[model samples]
Target: MNTSSTPTPESTSRLSEPVAGAPLVLPVIEEHAVVGREMVETGRVHLTKTVEEHEEALNFTLLHDEVQVERVPVNQYVADGATLPGVRYEGDTMVIPVVREVVVKRMLVVEELHITKHQVPTQESHRVVLRQESVQVTREPAPGTIIPPTASTPAS
Candidate 1:
Protein backbone atom coordinates (compact mmCIF):
# COMPACT_ATOMS: atom_id res chain seq x y z
CA MET A 1 0.00 0.00 0.00
CA ASN A 2 2.83 2.36 -0.98
CA THR A 3 1.39 4.95 -3.35
CA SER A 4 4.74 6.90 -3.71
CA SER A 5 4.53 10.27 -1.98
CA THR A 6 8.11 9.48 -0.73
CA PRO A 7 7.93 7.88 2.71
CA THR A 8 9.11 4.29 2.58
CA PRO A 9 10.39 2.47 5.60
CA GLU A 10 7.03 0.83 5.78
CA SER A 11 5.65 4.36 5.39
CA THR A 12 7.98 5.65 8.14
CA SER A 13 6.75 2.93 10.54
CA ARG A 14 3.18 3.76 9.61
CA LEU A 15 3.74 7.50 10.11
CA SER A 16 5.11 6.89 13.64
CA GLU A 17 1.95 5.18 14.97
CA PRO A 18 -1.18 7.34 15.10
CA VAL A 19 -4.12 5.47 13.86
CA ALA A 20 -6.55 5.91 16.71
CA GLY A 21 -7.70 9.27 15.28
CA ALA A 22 -7.19 7.99 11.73
CA PRO A 23 -6.99 11.56 10.35
CA LEU A 24 -3.87 13.15 11.94
CA VAL A 25 -1.28 14.73 9.60
CA LEU A 26 0.16 17.50 11.85
CA PRO A 27 2.57 19.96 10.19
CA VAL A 28 2.03 23.75 9.88
CA ILE A 29 4.79 26.55 9.92
CA GLU A 30 5.07 30.19 8.68
CA GLU A 31 7.57 33.13 9.12
CA HIS A 32 7.90 36.37 7.11
CA ALA A 33 10.48 39.31 7.22
CA VAL A 34 11.80 41.19 4.15
CA VAL A 35 13.48 44.64 4.45
CA GLY A 36 16.00 46.48 2.10
CA ARG A 37 17.92 49.80 1.86
CA GLU A 38 21.45 50.88 0.72
CA MET A 39 23.84 53.86 0.91
CA VAL A 40 26.71 53.62 3.48
CA GLU A 41 30.03 55.44 2.95
CA THR A 42 30.53 57.02 6.46
CA GLY A 43 33.27 59.75 5.96
CA ARG A 44 34.55 62.65 3.84
CA VAL A 45 35.05 66.46 4.28
CA HIS A 46 38.09 68.86 4.13
CA LEU A 47 38.95 72.43 2.99
CA THR A 48 41.89 74.71 3.83
CA LYS A 49 43.73 77.82 2.63
CA THR A 50 46.66 80.18 3.52
CA VAL A 51 47.91 83.22 1.62
CA GLU A 52 50.38 86.11 2.29
CA GLU A 53 52.25 88.63 0.11
CA HIS A 54 54.64 91.52 0.83
CA GLU A 55 57.20 93.56 -1.15
CA GLU A 56 59.66 96.02 0.32
CA ALA A 57 62.97 97.62 -0.83
CA LEU A 58 64.02 100.36 1.54
CA ASN A 59 67.72 101.02 2.29
CA PHE A 60 69.50 102.93 5.09
CA THR A 61 72.94 102.03 6.45
CA LEU A 62 75.25 103.97 8.85
CA LEU A 63 78.42 102.75 10.61
CA HIS A 64 81.06 105.12 12.08
CA ASP A 65 83.74 103.82 14.48
CA GLU A 66 86.57 106.39 14.31
CA VAL A 67 89.50 106.53 16.75
CA GLN A 68 92.68 108.50 15.99
CA VAL A 69 95.10 109.85 18.63
CA GLU A 70 98.60 111.07 17.72
CA ARG A 71 101.29 112.54 19.96
CA VAL A 72 105.00 112.20 19.06
CA PRO A 73 108.23 113.13 20.86
CA VAL A 74 111.26 110.87 21.37
CA ASN A 75 114.34 112.01 23.37
CA GLN A 76 115.76 108.67 22.25
CA TYR A 77 118.56 107.48 24.53
CA VAL A 78 118.49 103.97 25.95
CA ALA A 79 121.68 101.85 26.01
CA ASP A 80 122.87 100.86 29.44
CA GLY A 81 120.92 97.53 29.74
CA ALA A 82 118.78 98.17 26.77
CA THR A 83 116.14 95.56 25.94
CA LEU A 84 113.17 97.80 26.71
CA PRO A 85 110.88 98.91 23.91
CA GLY A 86 107.69 96.88 23.91
CA VAL A 87 104.25 97.07 22.20
CA ARG A 88 104.53 97.73 18.47
CA TYR A 89 102.19 96.80 15.55
CA GLU A 90 101.96 98.97 12.45
CA GLY A 91 99.39 97.57 9.99
CA ASP A 92 96.34 99.17 11.58
CA THR A 93 98.84 101.28 13.59
CA MET A 94 99.43 100.72 17.32
CA VAL A 95 102.86 101.65 18.71
CA ILE A 96 103.08 102.53 22.43
CA PRO A 97 106.34 102.86 24.45
CA VAL A 98 106.99 105.87 26.74
CA VAL A 99 109.74 105.88 29.37
CA ARG A 100 111.79 108.66 31.03
CA GLU A 101 114.47 108.59 33.81
CA VAL A 102 116.97 111.13 32.58
CA VAL A 103 119.28 113.70 34.22
CA VAL A 104 122.06 111.06 34.27
CA LYS A 105 120.18 107.96 35.08
CA ARG A 106 119.74 106.59 31.58
CA MET A 107 116.50 105.12 30.19
CA LEU A 108 114.76 107.67 28.06
CA VAL A 109 112.30 106.60 25.35
CA VAL A 110 110.19 109.64 26.04
CA GLU A 111 106.67 109.83 24.68
CA GLU A 112 105.72 107.71 21.65
CA LEU A 113 102.16 106.44 21.13
CA HIS A 114 100.37 106.55 17.77
CA ILE A 115 97.08 104.64 17.71
CA THR A 116 94.77 104.82 14.64
CA LYS A 117 91.76 102.79 13.50
CA HIS A 118 88.98 104.25 11.34
CA GLN A 119 86.03 102.92 9.31
CA VAL A 120 83.26 105.23 8.17
CA PRO A 121 80.42 104.02 5.86
CA THR A 122 77.43 106.30 5.98
CA GLN A 123 74.38 106.42 3.64
CA GLU A 124 71.36 108.06 5.18
CA SER A 125 68.25 108.39 3.02
CA HIS A 126 64.90 108.58 4.80
CA ARG A 127 61.48 108.10 3.21
CA VAL A 128 59.42 105.28 4.71
CA VAL A 129 55.72 104.98 5.68
CA LEU A 130 54.57 101.38 5.51
CA ARG A 131 51.44 99.62 6.75
CA GLN A 132 49.73 97.25 4.35
CA GLU A 133 47.82 94.05 5.25
CA SER A 134 44.87 92.45 3.50
CA VAL A 135 43.32 88.99 3.98
CA GLN A 136 39.79 87.62 3.45
CA VAL A 137 38.45 84.06 3.40
CA THR A 138 34.65 83.74 3.60
CA ARG A 139 32.09 81.02 2.96
CA GLU A 140 28.96 82.06 4.86
CA PRO A 141 25.80 80.38 3.67
CA ALA A 142 23.20 78.69 5.88
CA PRO A 143 19.85 80.43 5.61
CA GLY A 144 18.37 78.94 2.51
CA THR A 145 21.93 78.21 1.48
CA ILE A 146 23.21 78.19 -2.08
CA ILE A 147 26.86 78.47 -3.10
CA PRO A 148 27.85 77.60 -6.65
CA PRO A 149 30.91 79.42 -7.97
CA THR A 150 34.49 78.31 -7.57
CA ALA A 151 37.81 79.46 -8.94
CA SER A 152 38.28 81.32 -5.71
CA THR A 153 34.66 82.39 -5.31
CA PRO A 154 33.46 84.93 -7.86
CA ALA A 155 29.70 85.38 -8.22
CA SER A 156 28.76 88.73 -6.68
Candidate 2:
Protein backbone atom coordinates (compact mmCIF):
# COMPACT_ATOMS: atom_id res chain seq x y z
CA MET A 1 0.00 0.00 0.00
CA ASN A 2 1.16 3.70 -0.82
CA THR A 3 0.76 6.80 1.69
CA SER A 4 0.34 10.44 0.38
CA SER A 5 -0.63 13.87 1.98
CA THR A 6 -2.40 16.94 0.37
CA PRO A 7 -3.98 20.43 1.56
CA THR A 8 -7.79 20.89 1.18
CA PRO A 9 -9.13 24.14 -0.67
CA GLU A 10 -11.67 24.97 2.09
CA SER A 11 -8.92 25.23 4.78
CA THR A 12 -6.76 27.67 2.66
CA SER A 13 -9.67 30.20 2.17
CA ARG A 14 -10.53 30.44 5.97
CA LEU A 15 -6.96 31.48 6.96
CA SER A 16 -6.72 34.59 4.62
CA GLU A 17 -9.09 37.22 6.35
CA PRO A 18 -8.96 40.64 8.48
CA VAL A 19 -11.65 42.25 10.87
CA ALA A 20 -13.37 45.80 10.25
CA GLY A 21 -13.78 48.91 12.63
CA ALA A 22 -16.92 49.71 14.82
CA PRO A 23 -19.76 51.81 13.26
CA LEU A 24 -20.91 53.91 16.47
CA VAL A 25 -19.20 56.83 18.47
CA LEU A 26 -19.64 57.82 22.23
CA PRO A 27 -20.80 61.43 23.48
CA VAL A 28 -18.69 63.74 25.84
CA ILE A 29 -20.11 65.25 29.22
CA GLU A 30 -19.22 68.66 30.90
CA GLU A 31 -19.44 69.55 34.72
CA HIS A 32 -20.30 72.98 36.21
CA ALA A 33 -17.77 74.78 38.64
CA VAL A 34 -18.85 76.44 42.00
CA VAL A 35 -17.30 79.38 44.05
CA GLY A 36 -17.82 80.07 47.82
CA ARG A 37 -17.47 83.16 50.15
CA GLU A 38 -17.29 83.54 53.99
CA MET A 39 -19.43 86.10 55.95
CA VAL A 40 -18.77 87.54 59.50
CA GLU A 41 -20.84 89.90 61.78
CA THR A 42 -19.54 92.41 64.37
CA GLY A 43 -20.42 92.51 68.10
CA ARG A 44 -21.90 95.56 69.99
CA VAL A 45 -19.72 97.76 72.26
CA HIS A 46 -20.33 97.97 76.09
CA LEU A 47 -21.70 101.29 77.52
CA THR A 48 -20.85 102.41 81.09
CA LYS A 49 -23.78 104.82 81.36
CA THR A 50 -26.28 102.08 80.51
CA VAL A 51 -24.78 99.82 83.16
CA GLU A 52 -24.93 102.68 85.76
CA GLU A 53 -28.55 103.43 84.94
CA HIS A 54 -29.46 99.75 85.31
CA GLU A 55 -27.71 99.55 88.67
CA GLU A 56 -29.52 102.69 89.88
CA ALA A 57 -32.91 101.33 88.84
CA LEU A 58 -32.30 98.08 90.75
CA ASN A 59 -30.55 99.70 93.74
CA PHE A 60 -31.80 99.03 97.32
CA THR A 61 -31.03 101.07 100.44
CA LEU A 62 -30.14 99.58 103.81
CA LEU A 63 -29.54 101.36 107.18
CA HIS A 64 -28.01 99.85 110.31
CA ASP A 65 -27.24 101.16 113.88
CA GLU A 66 -25.27 99.41 116.62
CA VAL A 67 -24.80 100.74 120.15
CA GLN A 68 -23.05 99.00 123.05
CA VAL A 69 -23.39 100.12 126.70
CA GLU A 70 -21.68 98.58 129.71
CA ARG A 71 -22.32 99.25 133.38
CA VAL A 72 -19.95 97.90 136.08
CA PRO A 73 -20.27 98.32 139.88
CA VAL A 74 -17.54 97.84 142.48
CA ASN A 75 -18.04 97.03 146.16
CA GLN A 76 -15.78 96.44 149.14
CA TYR A 77 -15.84 93.78 151.85
CA VAL A 78 -14.24 93.07 155.23
CA ALA A 79 -10.90 91.24 155.22
CA ASP A 80 -11.67 88.78 158.02
CA GLY A 81 -14.78 87.43 159.83
CA ALA A 82 -13.44 88.80 163.15
CA THR A 83 -14.07 92.35 161.89
CA LEU A 84 -17.83 91.69 162.26
CA PRO A 85 -17.99 89.00 164.90
CA GLY A 86 -21.12 87.17 166.21
CA VAL A 87 -23.04 87.38 162.90
CA ARG A 88 -25.97 84.89 162.71
CA TYR A 89 -26.52 84.78 158.92
CA GLU A 90 -23.82 84.24 156.32
CA GLY A 91 -24.59 87.52 154.44
CA ASP A 92 -26.11 89.60 157.25
CA THR A 93 -26.18 93.28 156.14
CA MET A 94 -25.97 94.58 159.72
CA VAL A 95 -22.86 92.57 160.69
CA ILE A 96 -20.98 93.29 157.41
CA PRO A 97 -19.01 96.54 157.19
CA VAL A 98 -19.74 98.67 154.10
CA VAL A 99 -16.51 99.82 152.56
CA ARG A 100 -16.57 101.53 149.18
CA GLU A 101 -13.92 101.28 146.43
CA VAL A 102 -13.37 104.11 143.95
CA VAL A 103 -12.50 103.07 140.39
CA VAL A 104 -11.14 105.25 137.53
CA LYS A 105 -11.87 104.11 133.95
CA ARG A 106 -10.60 105.33 130.58
CA MET A 107 -12.91 105.69 127.56
CA LEU A 108 -12.14 105.47 123.82
CA VAL A 109 -14.21 105.93 120.66
CA VAL A 110 -13.50 104.93 117.00
CA GLU A 111 -15.40 105.63 113.77
CA GLU A 112 -14.92 104.78 110.08
CA LEU A 113 -16.58 105.89 106.83
CA HIS A 114 -16.26 104.97 103.15
CA ILE A 115 -17.75 106.39 99.96
CA THR A 116 -17.53 105.31 96.29
CA LYS A 117 -18.81 106.75 92.97
CA HIS A 118 -18.80 105.46 89.41
CA GLN A 119 -19.92 106.28 85.80
CA VAL A 120 -20.61 110.08 86.06
CA PRO A 121 -17.27 111.08 87.63
CA THR A 122 -15.98 108.39 89.99
CA GLN A 123 -14.87 109.40 93.51
CA GLU A 124 -13.68 107.41 96.53
CA SER A 125 -13.38 108.82 100.05
CA HIS A 126 -12.50 107.33 103.45
CA ARG A 127 -12.45 108.86 106.95
CA VAL A 128 -11.50 107.62 110.41
CA VAL A 129 -12.15 109.32 113.77
CA LEU A 130 -10.69 108.34 117.12
CA ARG A 131 -11.44 109.82 120.55
CA GLN A 132 -9.54 108.98 123.71
CA GLU A 133 -9.20 110.31 127.25
CA SER A 134 -5.89 111.83 128.40
CA VAL A 135 -3.98 110.20 131.23
CA GLN A 136 -1.24 111.88 133.31
CA VAL A 137 1.43 109.83 135.07
CA THR A 138 3.91 111.47 137.46
CA ARG A 139 6.93 109.95 139.16
CA GLU A 140 8.93 111.36 142.07
CA PRO A 141 12.25 109.67 141.21
CA ALA A 142 13.73 108.76 137.79
CA PRO A 143 13.62 105.09 136.75
CA GLY A 144 16.72 102.69 136.97
CA THR A 145 18.49 104.94 139.58
CA ILE A 146 18.98 104.14 143.21
CA ILE A 147 20.02 106.81 145.71
CA PRO A 148 21.30 105.97 149.17
CA PRO A 149 19.77 107.83 152.05
CA THR A 150 22.28 110.10 153.68
CA ALA A 151 19.81 111.86 155.91
CA SER A 152 16.67 112.66 153.86
CA THR A 153 15.39 109.32 152.42
CA PRO A 154 12.02 108.24 153.80
CA ALA A 155 10.19 104.89 153.49
CA SER A 156 7.16 105.00 151.13
Candidate 3:
Protein backbone atom coordinates (compact mmCIF):
# COMPACT_ATOMS: atom_id res chain seq x y z
CA MET A 1 0.00 0.00 0.00
CA ASN A 2 1.15 3.45 -0.86
CA THR A 3 1.78 5.62 2.24
CA SER A 4 1.04 8.95 0.42
CA SER A 5 -2.66 9.83 -0.39
CA THR A 6 -3.63 11.06 -3.87
CA PRO A 7 -4.48 14.87 -4.23
CA THR A 8 -8.22 15.74 -4.69
CA PRO A 9 -9.37 18.36 -7.29
CA GLU A 10 -10.98 21.53 -5.90
CA SER A 11 -14.43 22.68 -7.30
CA THR A 12 -14.47 26.20 -8.86
CA SER A 13 -18.22 26.16 -9.81
CA ARG A 14 -19.31 27.83 -6.52
CA LEU A 15 -16.96 30.79 -6.94
CA SER A 16 -18.17 33.94 -8.78
CA GLU A 17 -15.94 36.63 -10.28
CA PRO A 18 -16.45 39.95 -12.16
CA VAL A 19 -15.47 40.10 -15.81
CA ALA A 20 -13.78 43.07 -17.52
CA GLY A 21 -15.47 45.11 -20.32
CA ALA A 22 -18.95 43.98 -19.22
CA PRO A 23 -21.85 46.36 -20.16
CA LEU A 24 -23.85 47.82 -17.28
CA VAL A 25 -27.67 47.91 -17.55
CA LEU A 26 -29.96 50.40 -15.73
CA PRO A 27 -33.75 50.84 -15.49
CA VAL A 28 -35.29 53.67 -17.59
CA ILE A 29 -37.94 56.05 -16.26
CA GLU A 30 -40.44 58.20 -18.23
CA GLU A 31 -42.03 61.43 -17.01
CA HIS A 32 -43.99 64.38 -18.42
CA ALA A 33 -43.84 68.13 -17.69
CA VAL A 34 -46.28 70.96 -18.43
CA VAL A 35 -44.97 74.10 -20.11
CA GLY A 36 -46.57 77.55 -20.30
CA ARG A 37 -45.95 80.67 -22.39
CA GLU A 38 -44.90 84.07 -21.18
CA MET A 39 -47.35 86.86 -20.42
CA VAL A 40 -47.13 90.45 -21.74
CA GLU A 41 -49.16 93.57 -20.91
CA THR A 42 -49.77 96.70 -22.99
CA GLY A 43 -51.01 100.14 -21.93
CA ARG A 44 -53.05 102.80 -23.72
CA VAL A 45 -52.34 103.66 -27.38
CA HIS A 46 -53.30 106.82 -29.35
CA LEU A 47 -53.91 107.29 -33.07
CA THR A 48 -53.59 110.34 -35.34
CA LYS A 49 -54.93 110.76 -38.90
CA THR A 50 -54.30 113.50 -41.47
CA VAL A 51 -55.57 114.17 -45.03
CA GLU A 52 -54.65 116.85 -47.59
CA GLU A 53 -55.73 117.61 -51.17
CA HIS A 54 -55.28 120.42 -53.76
CA GLU A 55 -56.14 121.30 -57.45
CA GLU A 56 -55.10 124.16 -59.73
CA ALA A 57 -58.20 124.40 -62.05
CA LEU A 58 -60.73 122.94 -59.55
CA ASN A 59 -61.64 123.19 -55.87
CA PHE A 60 -59.28 121.65 -53.25
CA THR A 61 -59.78 120.32 -49.70
CA LEU A 62 -57.36 119.67 -46.85
CA LEU A 63 -57.91 117.96 -43.50
CA HIS A 64 -55.40 117.48 -40.65
CA ASP A 65 -55.43 116.10 -37.09
CA GLU A 66 -52.95 115.98 -34.18
CA VAL A 67 -52.79 113.59 -31.20
CA GLN A 68 -50.66 113.25 -28.01
CA VAL A 69 -50.88 110.52 -25.44
CA GLU A 70 -49.16 108.72 -22.54
CA ARG A 71 -49.13 105.17 -21.22
CA VAL A 72 -49.37 103.54 -17.76
CA PRO A 73 -46.70 102.33 -15.40
CA VAL A 74 -44.35 99.65 -16.77
CA ASN A 75 -42.01 97.52 -14.68
CA GLN A 76 -38.42 97.12 -15.80
CA TYR A 77 -35.77 95.11 -13.97
CA VAL A 78 -32.13 96.03 -14.36
CA ALA A 79 -29.91 93.14 -13.36
CA ASP A 80 -26.23 93.43 -12.54
CA GLY A 81 -23.76 90.83 -13.79
CA ALA A 82 -26.49 89.19 -15.80
CA THR A 83 -24.36 88.69 -18.89
CA LEU A 84 -21.25 87.38 -17.07
CA PRO A 85 -20.35 83.78 -17.95
CA GLY A 86 -20.50 82.55 -14.36
CA VAL A 87 -22.93 81.55 -11.67
CA ARG A 88 -24.48 84.34 -9.59
CA TYR A 89 -25.32 83.89 -5.95
CA GLU A 90 -27.85 85.63 -3.74
CA GLY A 91 -26.94 88.83 -1.85
CA ASP A 92 -24.24 89.65 -4.36
CA THR A 93 -23.91 93.39 -5.02
CA MET A 94 -22.99 94.36 -8.58
CA VAL A 95 -23.38 97.36 -10.83
CA ILE A 96 -26.03 97.40 -13.57
CA PRO A 97 -24.15 97.11 -16.86
CA VAL A 98 -26.98 98.35 -19.06
CA VAL A 99 -29.19 101.40 -18.88
CA ARG A 100 -32.84 100.37 -18.36
CA GLU A 101 -35.06 102.30 -20.71
CA VAL A 102 -38.85 102.48 -21.17
CA VAL A 103 -39.87 103.11 -24.76
CA VAL A 104 -43.16 103.76 -26.57
CA LYS A 105 -43.88 103.14 -30.25
CA ARG A 106 -45.94 105.66 -32.23
CA MET A 107 -47.22 105.80 -35.81
CA LEU A 108 -48.66 108.61 -37.91
CA VAL A 109 -51.37 107.71 -40.49
CA VAL A 110 -51.76 109.96 -43.51
CA GLU A 111 -54.18 109.80 -46.50
CA GLU A 112 -54.31 111.99 -49.60
CA LEU A 113 -57.76 113.26 -50.61
CA HIS A 114 -56.60 114.32 -54.12
CA ILE A 115 -53.43 113.62 -56.12
CA THR A 116 -53.12 117.16 -57.54
CA LYS A 117 -53.63 118.74 -54.08
CA HIS A 118 -51.22 116.35 -52.38
CA GLN A 119 -48.60 116.85 -55.14
CA VAL A 120 -46.95 113.44 -54.69
CA PRO A 121 -47.08 113.64 -50.91
CA THR A 122 -45.17 111.27 -48.66
CA GLN A 123 -46.79 108.42 -46.67
CA GLU A 124 -46.97 107.54 -42.94
CA SER A 125 -44.22 107.77 -40.40
CA HIS A 126 -43.23 105.83 -37.24
CA ARG A 127 -41.20 106.89 -34.22
CA VAL A 128 -40.15 105.55 -30.86
CA VAL A 129 -39.88 107.69 -27.72
CA LEU A 130 -38.04 106.87 -24.52
CA ARG A 131 -39.43 108.20 -21.27
CA GLN A 132 -37.68 108.38 -17.95
CA GLU A 133 -39.59 107.00 -15.01
CA SER A 134 -38.96 106.60 -11.31
CA VAL A 135 -37.73 103.18 -10.20
CA GLN A 136 -37.65 101.61 -6.73
CA VAL A 137 -35.31 98.74 -5.91
CA THR A 138 -35.15 96.73 -2.73
CA ARG A 139 -33.35 93.63 -1.52
CA GLU A 140 -33.83 91.32 1.43
CA PRO A 141 -31.15 89.70 3.54
CA ALA A 142 -30.35 85.99 3.55
CA PRO A 143 -32.56 83.63 5.52
CA GLY A 144 -29.86 82.59 8.02
CA THR A 145 -28.00 84.75 10.51
CA ILE A 146 -25.24 86.98 9.24
CA ILE A 147 -21.65 85.85 9.75
CA PRO A 148 -18.73 88.21 9.52
CA PRO A 149 -15.90 87.36 7.17
CA THR A 150 -12.75 85.85 8.68
CA ALA A 151 -10.54 88.51 7.17
CA SER A 152 -12.31 91.29 9.06
CA THR A 153 -11.50 89.94 12.56
CA PRO A 154 -8.21 88.78 14.01
CA ALA A 155 -7.67 85.03 14.51
CA SER A 156 -8.35 83.87 18.06
Candidate 4:
Protein backbone atom coordinates (compact mmCIF):
# COMPACT_ATOMS: atom_id res chain seq x y z
CA MET A 1 0.00 0.00 0.00
CA ASN A 2 1.14 3.65 -0.76
CA THR A 3 1.11 6.01 2.31
CA SER A 4 2.31 9.74 2.89
CA SER A 5 4.16 11.00 6.07
CA THR A 6 1.95 12.07 8.99
CA PRO A 7 1.59 15.87 9.49
CA THR A 8 2.76 17.39 12.78
CA PRO A 9 0.95 20.17 14.70
CA GLU A 10 3.61 22.77 13.77
CA SER A 11 3.41 21.96 10.09
CA THR A 12 -0.41 22.06 10.10
CA SER A 13 -0.43 25.51 11.78
CA ARG A 14 2.12 26.89 9.27
CA LEU A 15 -0.02 25.69 6.30
CA SER A 16 -3.14 27.31 7.74
CA GLU A 17 -1.50 30.80 8.23
CA PRO A 18 0.46 32.72 5.50
CA VAL A 19 4.02 33.87 6.30
CA ALA A 20 5.09 37.49 5.66
CA GLY A 21 8.55 38.41 4.32
CA ALA A 22 8.32 42.11 5.42
CA PRO A 23 7.19 43.79 8.65
CA LEU A 24 3.60 45.05 8.94
CA VAL A 25 2.81 48.76 8.53
CA LEU A 26 0.46 50.65 10.95
CA PRO A 27 -1.03 54.25 10.79
CA VAL A 28 -0.29 56.55 13.80
CA ILE A 29 -2.33 59.68 14.68
CA GLU A 30 -0.79 62.47 16.82
CA GLU A 31 -2.05 65.98 17.77
CA HIS A 32 0.44 68.86 17.78
CA ALA A 33 0.08 72.35 19.38
CA VAL A 34 1.66 75.41 17.75
CA VAL A 35 2.55 78.50 19.83
CA GLY A 36 3.13 81.98 18.33
CA ARG A 37 2.70 85.66 19.15
CA GLU A 38 0.36 88.09 17.35
CA MET A 39 -0.40 91.77 17.88
CA VAL A 40 -4.04 92.90 18.37
CA GLU A 41 -6.06 95.93 19.45
CA THR A 42 -7.82 95.61 22.79
CA GLY A 43 -8.49 98.99 24.41
CA ARG A 44 -7.57 102.69 24.08
CA VAL A 45 -6.78 105.46 26.57
CA HIS A 46 -7.42 109.17 26.06
CA LEU A 47 -6.01 112.29 27.75
CA THR A 48 -7.20 115.87 27.65
CA LYS A 49 -5.94 119.18 29.01
CA THR A 50 -8.25 122.10 29.59
CA VAL A 51 -7.56 125.73 30.39
CA GLU A 52 -9.78 127.74 32.75
CA GLU A 53 -10.22 131.50 32.88
CA HIS A 54 -11.56 133.64 35.75
CA GLU A 55 -11.93 137.30 36.68
CA GLU A 56 -10.85 138.93 39.96
CA ALA A 57 -11.23 142.43 41.38
CA LEU A 58 -8.48 144.03 43.41
CA ASN A 59 -8.52 147.26 45.49
CA PHE A 60 -5.42 149.19 46.52
CA THR A 61 -4.30 152.65 47.61
CA LEU A 62 -2.13 155.09 45.60
CA LEU A 63 -0.20 158.16 46.82
CA HIS A 64 0.61 161.36 44.94
CA ASP A 65 2.16 164.85 45.56
CA GLU A 66 0.22 168.09 45.69
CA VAL A 67 1.08 171.82 46.25
CA GLN A 68 -1.12 174.68 47.46
CA VAL A 69 -0.51 178.48 47.65
CA GLU A 70 -2.29 181.22 49.60
CA ARG A 71 -1.95 185.02 49.53
CA VAL A 72 -2.14 187.36 52.64
CA PRO A 73 -1.86 191.12 53.12
CA VAL A 74 1.41 192.13 54.92
CA ASN A 75 2.04 195.78 55.96
CA GLN A 76 5.79 195.88 56.64
CA TYR A 77 8.87 198.01 55.84
CA VAL A 78 12.29 196.73 54.87
CA ALA A 79 15.49 198.78 54.61
CA ASP A 80 17.83 198.66 51.66
CA GLY A 81 20.80 196.23 51.46
CA ALA A 82 18.66 193.70 53.39
CA THR A 83 18.13 190.16 52.05
CA LEU A 84 14.46 189.14 51.51
CA PRO A 85 12.99 185.60 51.44
CA GLY A 86 14.29 183.58 48.43
CA VAL A 87 13.07 180.64 46.37
CA ARG A 88 14.33 177.15 47.33
CA TYR A 89 13.42 173.51 46.55
CA GLU A 90 12.65 171.18 49.50
CA GLY A 91 12.34 167.43 48.64
CA ASP A 92 9.84 167.79 45.70
CA THR A 93 8.27 171.17 46.55
CA MET A 94 9.29 174.73 45.53
CA VAL A 95 9.09 177.46 48.18
CA ILE A 96 9.24 181.23 47.50
CA PRO A 97 9.68 184.08 49.99
CA VAL A 98 7.64 187.25 49.52
CA VAL A 99 8.37 190.69 51.05
CA ARG A 100 6.68 194.10 50.57
CA GLU A 101 6.86 197.58 52.17
CA VAL A 102 3.77 197.96 54.42
CA VAL A 103 2.76 200.04 57.40
CA VAL A 104 2.73 197.07 59.84
CA LYS A 105 4.23 193.51 59.91
CA ARG A 106 2.11 190.46 58.90
CA MET A 107 2.43 186.67 58.79
CA LEU A 108 2.07 184.21 55.87
CA VAL A 109 1.33 180.48 55.72
CA VAL A 110 2.03 177.86 52.95
CA GLU A 111 0.99 174.20 52.62
CA GLU A 112 2.52 171.44 50.48
CA LEU A 113 2.47 167.67 50.21
CA HIS A 114 5.26 165.29 49.07
CA ILE A 115 4.79 161.71 47.85
CA THR A 116 7.19 158.85 46.85
CA LYS A 117 6.35 156.01 44.47
CA HIS A 118 7.66 152.38 44.51
CA GLN A 119 6.77 149.16 42.73
CA VAL A 120 5.48 146.18 44.77
CA PRO A 121 5.71 142.60 43.49
CA THR A 122 3.07 140.05 44.46
CA GLN A 123 2.61 136.29 43.77
CA GLU A 124 -0.75 134.86 42.74
CA SER A 125 -2.09 131.33 42.24
CA HIS A 126 -4.86 129.89 40.04
CA ARG A 127 -6.54 126.54 39.44
CA VAL A 128 -5.94 124.53 36.25
CA VAL A 129 -7.02 121.15 34.83
CA LEU A 130 -4.40 118.52 34.08
CA ARG A 131 -4.81 115.27 32.20
CA GLN A 132 -2.68 112.18 31.75
CA GLU A 133 -2.66 109.07 29.58
CA SER A 134 -2.11 105.43 30.50
CA VAL A 135 -2.09 102.06 28.79
CA GLN A 136 -4.29 99.04 29.72
CA VAL A 137 -3.41 95.45 28.80
CA THR A 138 -6.21 93.01 28.04
CA ARG A 139 -6.02 89.28 27.17
CA GLU A 140 -8.40 88.02 24.55
CA PRO A 141 -8.57 84.72 22.69
CA ALA A 142 -8.00 84.68 18.94
CA PRO A 143 -10.98 84.66 16.54
CA GLY A 144 -10.92 80.93 15.69
CA THR A 145 -8.97 78.35 17.68
CA ILE A 146 -9.85 75.43 15.40
CA ILE A 147 -7.35 74.61 12.70
CA PRO A 148 -8.62 74.26 9.13
CA PRO A 149 -8.32 70.92 7.32
CA THR A 150 -5.41 70.62 4.94
CA ALA A 151 -5.16 68.59 1.71
CA SER A 152 -2.77 66.08 3.35
CA THR A 153 -5.24 65.39 6.18
CA PRO A 154 -7.67 62.50 5.83
CA ALA A 155 -11.36 63.40 5.61
CA SER A 156 -13.69 62.13 8.36
Q: For this target, which candidate reaches the highest lDDT against the unseen true structure?
A: 1
| Local accuracy of candidate 3 as per-residue lDDT tens digits, 1-156 | 234566333333343333477665555789999999885433333444434343224234445543322232324343443442222222422222222333432221121111111123334444444344444444434446464666767789
- Candidate 3 regions exceeding 4 Å error are 1-27, 41-46, 59-156
lDDT by residue (tens digit), candidate 2, 46-144: 333211111122333444433332222323333433242232322311222223332433221121112222233334444444344444444444444
Over 1-156, each residue of candidate 4 has an lDDT whose tens digit, in order, gives 224588666665533333477555555879999999998744344545454445554445555544455443443444445566456666655555565444344332232223323444455455554445555555444555444566686789
**Residue 133 in model 3: shift from native, Å?**
35
lDDT of 3: 0.37
- Clash numbers, per candidate: 0, 0, 1, 2
**Colliding pairs, model 4:** 75-104, 76-102
lDDT of 3 at 136: 46
The list of candidate 4 runs beyond 4 A from truth reads 1-45, 88-95, 99-156
lDDT digits (tens) for residues 1-156 of candidate 1: 568899777666634667696888866768888899897544334345444445555778889989888878987888998788998988998989889787898898888889988888998776555565555555445555455776676789
- Ten-residue stretch with the least lDDT total in model 3: 108-117
* Residue 69 of model 2, lDDT score: 28
Candidate models: Cα lDDT each: 0.75, 0.36, 0.37, 0.49
Q: Cα RMSD for candidate 3?
A: 40.1
